[model samples]
Target chain A: MLIALLWYLGAVIFTWALGLFLLWRIEKSGVKRWGATGRLFTYK
Target chain B: MQWYIGAMALYAAFLIWTNVKSLKMAESASDFTAGGHRMGLLLGTGTTTATWVSVASVLGIPAFLYSDGAAAIIGWMAGWIFGGALIPIVGYKIRRPANPARTFPEFVRMRYDMFARRSFLQALIGVVMFIGYLFLVNIQATGFGIVFSSITGVDYKVAIFGFLIFIVITNVGGFWSVATTDTLNAAVIAIGCIAAAVTVLLSTGGLGNILDTLAVTTAPINEGGPALDPGVLLTPTGSFGSAALLSIFISNSLGTPSSPHWVARMLAPMNVKVAVLQIMANVVVLLVIWLPLIVMGLGAKALIPSLPEGVATDYVIPLLLQEHTPVLVAALTLVAICAAAVSTGNSMLLTCSTSLYYDVYLNLFGRTVSDRALKNWLRFIVFVVAVIAVVLAIDPLWFLAMGFTYVYGGFGATFSLTVFLGLYWKRMNRAGAYASIIVGFVAFIIATAADVPVPFVVAVSASAVACLIAVYATKPPPLESYEPFFEAEISESTKVAVERVLKLNPAQQSEAVEVRSV
Candidate 1:
């Protein structure tokens, strides 16, 4: 009953689009301003 | 064989180049473990997708699809994609601390230690991580051995040994090396898998012809096997039946986000936004790998009517590359499978070793051990575990995917709910956290021993119930415990406590972390 290529394809398209959407949000959040500036960890 | 060897040499050279480059970049112990928490979008996406494309994804899923037909794909896609959807939730919550933990044990210690000396808890976490991740390391070894042997026509036992060298090199330069090499591997995997899928479609005359062949074929997978099932491959339930199908879906859905290394990857990103963004980015890229795998799995069956009597179903994809596809396609796809193995092996090896050395060992002694000594200790453990894992996969007991059910289920039941609740539930006290793990782990053991159907689902459910009950029964956690996660500013005392743990101070309550003279 769950076997529908068309339906699975749609979900695929939606999630693909979702990834790009969130990525856009990240750009808007000023990714450049905070580039790799997180506090670092060390063995010590 | 020459093509396979040539491509492998070139790939190995590039990987080594990255390894040497990363050696210099890992200045502190932190850089070794989490890439200095500086992973940008490209490397972040690459590592996530690479680690996610485990041997199980390439070999296991297709093996099931090869045998059981269309039903398997539905189960995997449903569970996996849904699990993929939750990455942001898990990532955002765990990365909440102003100075978040570099390792999983550190995260737990900070979050649930009333916000700071739970040695027993850390030890327990370490033990679980070691056992859980050991299975993962072994799974990679198993896949690497089979694929390498299949493509190169080498003995499985002999071929598997090369995996140890691969992992040691991958683990040598630490996380930066792992991420950089894995990024290269990820691109190769994506290209290889897609090419294999397109070739399969062309060979089978398209999906319609495949379904038609599967509809009436009663050919047994092995010689002289039960030859009675016709039209079952196209049937909704297929050969596996509905119960087994549902179980596959449930385990994957519950297990993916709950997998410790996946959450650990989130900690490596530049910030919480990057953490969330990486997973969101993963949805598109990971799907690129997953869709083709589904095609290759079913298409392999259509191309090769039935395998030899003794051959394992895991050989489906490798066999497709060897005989049916064009020389270039075969070489690339097989290399892709190899890439998947190395990609996963690097991370799992790191996690498994860290659990043993950092989490369990340091917690048992004390937190005062210097990072310099511990780094040496960690590398030693990586080599030791690689050898042990190779030993563990000596003989194939069942299909590759079958083993995942136990380990993933164990992790899911034991740690999944506790991790989730720890992140979201401010009321979740230490007692509740303890109860969840003890009860959840015990439930998984009992359910697995009892031969319960989809044991993970039952155990996770039990864990959830226990977690809730214990949290209410115990006293609420102090402001320190809940504040760092919920409030914008961490209390000064909590901040000092974090600094102490990070600095590796000798503990008063616990034993000293002195590396005593041998």
Candidate 2:
């Protein structure tokens, strides 16, 4: 049970951290490519 | 029971409010179809996840996992991950054109100028999209019927009517309403799936106990049947033969970029970056949620070794929640299932209506309706399609009984090859596009009717060969014909010269120029 719990916890944390990091990288590159006029950072 | 009713009542109220709010904003066909291409990352991510997950993820995956073991994940989840990766490669390029087409058929028509106006190809594509959405609607209705009937003891037929009422109300406002409500639905689904997973995990003594139980439990066989092999369930082959599994994986991953509903999502983002990120978010959410649900499926097997003999496997998730959780938690979980169904249904309905109204009704029929009139026509088409879907759902064809593999395979075979080749390969012409769609579609139908073992692979392979032959046999279109798709920004001289060379009618020339300037 302890191992299972740790595995689940690790998987969830790793997915979130990795996903957020990739998103940040993509957004930074997007802003560089198109600048503020592209509305990459703006919400609606 | 009362908690379930209360939750549904609250959700219905929320749907009604969103409909009213969005109806005010949805004044043009563009807003109704693609939210005027101004959707932000937050809403785009939410809708993308909500649309992709569907009831298939919430209900179908668990059912498969319950019957087959962890191997089901390879066929379904792996396909999703691979398909999500292709979004940047295929979908991003298609969306990057200066004058992005509003619908998939429109995109095809514009990209391949041979069928740009008044062609059978556009109408045929629109019909296929409409039928596909209808199939999706019926699937969502079936999911609703199962959850509603199980929870409230209402007849399944009666429960579907109740579900359809909510779908129609929410979709009356079109894409804006769908996107806003999808954000809320995505949150509900994420939270509810996690909560249910945690509850099941705790009750079943965690993932370790569940895995241990699954390791020993053998599937029961009827008389005169071969004794079941427990080993196959844990491997990638599972009950499906290896060839069939590979075909399913290819179909799911490769076909997704061309599915009309998903293609519509690619059109909703404000820019190419947002589109790419939205798909990334979908992948992450799917990965996080699916693992827990797989665990829950194993946990259910451990807790209830055998369901009642006649009970369908689709009931596994709901039955698990009802057995272990408190009334309120179970009720909330059921709401989440409904949200999954409703979200997908709304998106499919909007896509279907867009295809009908924009691709076929207006474009093919040569209607010069005003913008306001077009919006009204779209709403009416939505209502009409919902009614037909509801009637069909009443007698619901058990399409999913055959597995989602076939459906995704059909879409992928028909559109994937054409869209990918058309965008990347300069030699691709109208003949190739037509041959790919027609041959792929026909091959899929014939193979399915004949019960071929690897229908998807055969269909796609045949289509690819046909496409190659057609491309080589025909003369390539002029270099200027490909200019719009290749260039980031069209020069004034090139636009004027191309428009004159194509000899587009006055209306089309102006519309093309307008899209370019936007």
Best by lDDT: 1
Per-candidate RMSD, Å: 5.5, 4.6
What is the C-alpha RMSD, rounded to one decimal, of candidate 2?
4.6
Error of 2 at B444 (Å): 1.1
User: How well is each residue in B1-518 modelled by candidate 2, as lDDT tens digits?
Assistant: 88888988888888888788878866556667777666777888888878877777788877777776665576666675666666655555665654466678776776665435575676788888887788787788788888888788898888877766877787777788898888888888887888888898889888778877776667542223343465444555667777776766677777777776777777767666667667666766766667677777767777776677667777788888888987888888889889988998888887888787777776667767655666677777877887787677776576342345667778888888777887788788888889999999999889878988777778889999999999899999655446665556667764654445233222233232222111
Can you give the TM-score per candidate against the true fold?
0.90, 0.88
Would you give the TM-score of chain B in model 2?
A: 0.92
> When only chain A is evaluated, what TM-score does every model earn?
0.59, 0.62
Error of 1 at B7 (Å): 1.8
DockQ values, each candidate: 0.15, 0.13
Report the TM-score of candidate 2, chain A only. Answer: 0.62
